[model samples]
Target: MPEPERKSKITASRKLLLKSLMLAKAKEEWDQEIVDKQAEKERYLSERVTPLHTSGLSLSQLQDLCRELHEKVEIVDEERYDIEAKCNHNTREERPVEVGDWRKNVEAMSGMEGRKKMFDAAKSPTGQ
Candidate 1:
């Protein structure tokens, strides 16, 4: 096999070409990692928040809601995948999970306030 001639121009171009290829490969890897992370995060959030409404609903109603949410979640997941696939993300991170039911807080306060209101109402304006 004959050895190929190494032209100066070709050799010079190959370095830039290889460098650009390396950069592109690094960018592809970074982009895919970002998308994978985002998909995981979205999966975690969906697991956490989307099922709360079913806690108070009836069994049949809950089943219906689950079905609807499943469809919606699928759409959201697909769109998220599509968007993340095309995105050039420079930043990414996972968040901690935390949830609090404020309605229960309000209900507790309302129960307390009701007694106070009743007591005030019972106290007549004229204490003859």
Candidate 2:
């Protein structure tokens, strides 16, 4: 016969797993929102705002427009950075150990030419 406590513990774990899955889905949605915000910012700035400015807005209007743009840009950037920081934290926490000595070579070579040499060596059979 199964223990009552064991059955309850399984139920609790199932609830936790469901909650975790929902949170992961929510994070994916938030990441998509960040991507959408970036695209909208780019499109609005390039297609709508720039053309409007070039089409002859008055100096005061342009100044006001600039202020509005700055505020919205700052807000979007702040939200993006916040979400990205959270996502980055999750990624860093979940990262696996690197497989090879690439880290050591990167540290040793720390320059463009040195990196090129390493890359060239990696491509050669003699180096292998």
- Candidate that would win on TM-score: 2
* Top-scoring candidate (lDDT): 2
What are the Cα lDDT values of the candidates? 0.80, 0.86
Report the Cα lDDT for residue 37, model 1: 100
Model 1 TM: 0.32
lDDT of 2: 0.86
RMSD of each: 24.8, 16.3
Estimated TM-score for each candidate: 0.32, 0.33
Q: Distance from true position, residue 56, model 2, in Å?
A: 3.0
Candidate 2 residues lying further than 4 Å off, grouped into runs, are 1-53, 96-128
> Which parts of model 1 have CA positions greater than 4 angstroms off?
1-10, 52-128
Scanning candidate 2 in windows of ten residues, the lowest lDDT window is: 47-56
